[model samples]
Target: MTSLTSPTSGANRPARLGVQIAPQHAPYEKIRDTLTEVEALGADIAFNWDHFFPLSGDPDGLHFESWTMLAAWAEQTTTIQLGALVNCNSYRNADLQADMARTIDHISGGRFIFGTGAGWFERDYDEYGYEFGTPGSRLNALDDSLNRIEARWGKINPPPVHDIPVLIGGGGEKKTLRIVAQHADIWHSFGDPQVLEHKLGVLGEWCDKVGRDMSEIEISTELKTRTVEQADQLYDLGARLFTLGVSGPAYDLAPATDWLAWRDSKNA
Candidate 1:
């Protein structure tokens, strides 16, 4: 297995900007439009959460499966990278997940980052007939699945165009962070600067124990607002990838642009 490390060179490294397009709230065309606008505006990656139904509102509200939408986004966008914010590992077999990711990697010409996690969101499992086990069991499943994913990738006839970057999202102090150290190319968490600072500290401890360099694991988080001023603190704390989520139809680009300018200025 390859070491999951962040790229070096802090100041010269280009900040990554991404956006999550909520698939539950909009039709396909609207989702496509939002993706196009995000790409046009210089977003580095595009993502959608994996869930069978609407997570926030009505149980029966419009929602789409993650992989299908990713395949479409891979085909539609010319430059922006694409993937699920975190695919539920328990929902599919590890080998199947590997194949699906490889297919999408090809579809996107190797831009797919396979973000995954132990399945959460009880409603998804209970309603969809998947077993909703304890968190430990789910994490165990994720660990095994990741092993199979990497093994299967090696066995495939035509391998993925590039080694698909594995992204794992969760802030679990023990199991999740351990898995991130062992497997993830990127670690994503949602929290304020102080919380993230603490988590990074813990993550660093884990990296030391695992013999992995903490700087090699790219830190990613979602931004509710676009201002780089707020993001500056996170960047200082080692978060170089900032993502802003926009729901569709009116797919607002203002916040995305604000962050893009910040990224360019930093690069400049």
Candidate 2:
């Protein structure tokens, strides 16, 4: 297992805001425009999810593919790092995923973060003709995929312009954290401060067992119904990258503007 500690990930790093523009319930132009807006608003990262169907609201709402849109986003925006908030590892071959990431990295001038995880959307699997295996099987596959992705990054031509950061999403303590200790430069979870503190402890245990420094992996979490003061509690627990998710049809960025203001204050 390779250590993918990012030069930019650490507790001391300035706090940054990420906006996940959900690719559902809207037209592609709206989604693209939202990405542009996020960048203009000073978001450090712009993200989308990798699901075939809507994760909320209308189950049959309009949606788009994750990677292709990311490729286009590479050309559409500059300066802001972008990627799927968490890509489904089972959707494509590991090597292919790595190659595509490298291409997007080049296209974005090295601003792509390879965010991925063991797939969990059963609807996606069932509807897209992918085998919806049990949780353990998907995790095992994710472990294998990470190893392949890292190896492929090494073999690919015109390799990623930078040591592409890998962001692994999920808070499963046993297998997921262990894999995170091995491969991730960033670990994202939806855990509140209390839960995040406990999970960080568990992740520390895994890091020790795997001989990886816990400080090497940056902590990330979502800002769902949490106040900035509440987010401060998470910051106290070592979360540096805070994400705010906005769904489409109307990707209102008012909250993102507020979050970005908070981020500016933190960094200041």
Candidate 3:
């Protein structure tokens, strides 16, 4: 695992907002329109979750694949960086994920963020016929796959248009944080300020052991139920990228609009 700091990580980076368009319980046209709308609303990143079924409401509601939609989103939006909020590593081969990301990177004119995770959803594996291994085994697999993914990116023909930024999601202290300290350009977590503060301390210890600078990994967190004031606590702790999750038929972006204004105010 490489310990070099990512070029994109910095304390001076402006606070940025991302929106995760849940691709469930709605038609693809609805999803497509939501993507464009968020970009026009000035979101810094547009994301979709990798799930085989709806996480809420109906169990068999209308749904779509993640990376495929990301490819479409790449062409649909001209500015917003596109990727799965957290692509399931168990769903695809590591090399294929890298190549697919590179292809989309080209298609989007270098606007891509490779956000991935060890994948915890059991249904996605059971329904898709992937091995529903133990969490430790899955995490170990993720650690190995990331190395291969990075290696594949180097050897692929024509090469990636840019050093595709890697955004990893999870808050596990033992393995996940180690992985982030080694490879991530952006580290996204779902913890509250108290949880994040403690976990980040662990991450710093891991970084010290691996000879990585914790500051070289941009801190990210979800704004699922957080107010700007609540988010301010995280911002004070160094989180620069905030993601809001909008789901289903309506895909309400009013909250995102407010957050975008907050982001602009922070940057200013």
Candidate 4:
């Protein structure tokens, strides 16, 4: 794990907004349009999930690959930071992933967030001809892969524009938090204030064990199941990045606009 914290993810940074435009159940044009509109609407980050099929919707619904879309997004957007909500490490080689991330970072001029985790989608592995290993095995593999990724980044040609902030998304107390403490510049997970507080305490212990300043990691959570008041509570509990999940079809911005307004108010 490289000590790759971004100035934008540090304690001094403001509460940032991220939107995950789920690349499912929609045409490429619609997804691209939604992404363009999301950046225009003042999102600090834009994310897509790394899944081979729709997690919801019609089982075999329209879906797109994550990394390829990210490459396109690097060329498409200007200011918004881009990444997968959580890329599954089992699907790609560790060093290859690092190279791809570095390339996208250059294309986006240093605005790529490397969000990743151990894979959980059994179907993704089964369908893609990958071995669906046990949970513990997958996590151990993720642990190894991240170290390789960070090391590879250091050796890349015309190196990454920045240190390349790492965002680890998961709430598993034992393995995941330890990894986040060791590697992540941003720790994203699902929790209410109380849950988040507990997890933060656990993560703090891990940080202490790893000789890291807990404050060095920004707290991130999805806003899908949380209200504005609840989000305010999460903020009080130290969550600074709020992400809203966006999908195809209409890809409406009513909720995103509301949250962005709330973010500005808090930042103000």
Candidate 5:
């Protein structure tokens, strides 16, 4: 992989802070409140997970569909960019996903990000009647879907207002990272610094093989702990989008605020 130290201007930089608000634990009003508060507090993005049932303990817990919730978030929050942390590629057809993203992009006045991934969560696929293939097969499907999504975007009547950033979440070194290098504008991975460093190396290697510049792909990770030092470490490793997840009705904003403050401090 190309080992350039600094990111290119106009796209890459020190990571921006964002928050993922789980829609399964809260009412619509609560979700809206959290989005508004996060955007007001200077979050660069607000995200929701895509799933029909709770991935946690109870399967029957309150949940909302991802695309629909994103449509609402698009209309509700004026400033913050909004998207699914990673929409499951198995859940929707490629053309349909492209159309949905395009619509939401316009709804947000060009503040929509198209975050997607190879489907996981066996329960989601089985319960939803989607084909739950092996990891490699799912990656193949994801790769195909991404191609279709791009092609469909070109064919759509009104193109997306902006070239909506595509965020792909996963750390599979072989296939997933290769896909990230080829397709993702942003790649989201979940792990500690050591792990992320290793994956970033692998991702870079994939970029090299594909003749893609690693610096062009933004690195993102979930912020399990809210600490300035941890954020700094991630920044040092070339991660430019730090994300923290909060499950609601409790809608805790402490971590989100802390990270946002750290982002502002860096920019300051």
Candidate 6:
């Protein structure tokens, strides 16, 4: 079995379940209630995405902010790990983010996963008045921000209770994959079995180039659009962490039970 320090150390382990309780088109009461149920449902992780507006349903839907809700969840839930599915590095300074994450880690007693990525949604930039820089430029900023974030983590008083695992979300081959090899404790991506296999090879190459152990990084993927059988295929290809993504308003978890059952069987 793998220790929490290296959650992805073993070639075989339980298929961990994660749910993104998308904070959009729903009241905080409903969102809060759903989060409680998320932990009770036995999901290994709970995530809320970072964005100003709803990505689905209505363009002007009721939506809560990400980090604030996370802080609340840190105080609310007892066990399920919480964080943004992918926090936008372009939205805030890395130093502030490091402090916020450290505080949440303490609040949750060390269950926060720092999942982050380069910002992609232009609407978020335009509406919030951030520069919609070129993709390459944004990637560069993310690369720089991670360094600052790590440096800040060291300097922050009352350091994080745990190692504060880093999860980098992206599939960009050149800059993003290299960053993952260097920094991520978990790498989340959206790809089918074939695509996942190909990306794993590319990631392995990046690990070789950087001289890091690929086995140390957990492989995470979304399960919102795939079937249990399809997820089994992904697992065969080295993806162990599966996230069932449900957008807000209802916070549907009925569909996730099947995946949870599958996870149980796989672990057994």
For model 6, residues 16-112, the per-residue Cα lDDT tens digits are 9999998999899999999888899899999999999989899899998999999999999898999898999999998999999999999999999
Q: Least accurate stretch of 10 residues (summed lDDT) in model 2?
A: 1-10
State model 6's lDDT. Answer: 0.88
lDDT of all predictions, in order shown?
A: 0.84, 0.90, 0.89, 0.89, 0.85, 0.88
Better of 1 and 4 by TM-score: 4
RMSD of candidates 1 onward, in order: 4.5, 4.7, 4.6, 4.9, 2.9, 4.1
User: Could you give candidate 4's per-residue lDDT for residues 117-222 as a string of tens digits?
Assistant: 9999999999999998898898899999999999998888979999899999998888999999999999997966777777888898898899998888998998
The regions of model 6 sitting more than 4 angstroms off are 1-10
Q: Candidate 4: where is the Cα deviation over 4 Å?
A: 1-11
- Which pairs, if any, clash in model 5? 15-240
Candidate 5 displacement at residue 254 in angstroms: 1.5
lDDT of 4: 0.89
Q: Per-residue alpha-carbon lDDT of model 3 for 1-268, expressed as tens digits?
A: 1222233334587899999999998999998989889999999999999999988889899999999888888888898898888999999999999999999999999999999999998998998999989989999999999999999999999689999999999988889999999999999988777777788888889899999987888899999999767788788777899999999989999999999989998898
Q: What is the lDDT ranking, best to worst?
A: 2, 4, 3, 6, 5, 1
lDDT of 2 at 129: 95
Worst 10 contiguous positions by lDDT, candidate 6: 1-10
Off by over 4 Å in 2: 1-10
Residue ranges of candidate 5 with Cα displaced over 4 Å: 1-14
TM-score of each: 0.93, 0.96, 0.95, 0.95, 0.93, 0.95
TM-score, candidate 3, is: 0.95
Winner on lDDT between 1 and 6 is 6
Q: After superposition on all CA atoms, how large is the RMSD of candidate 2?
A: 4.7
lDDT: which is higher, 1 or 4? Answer: 4
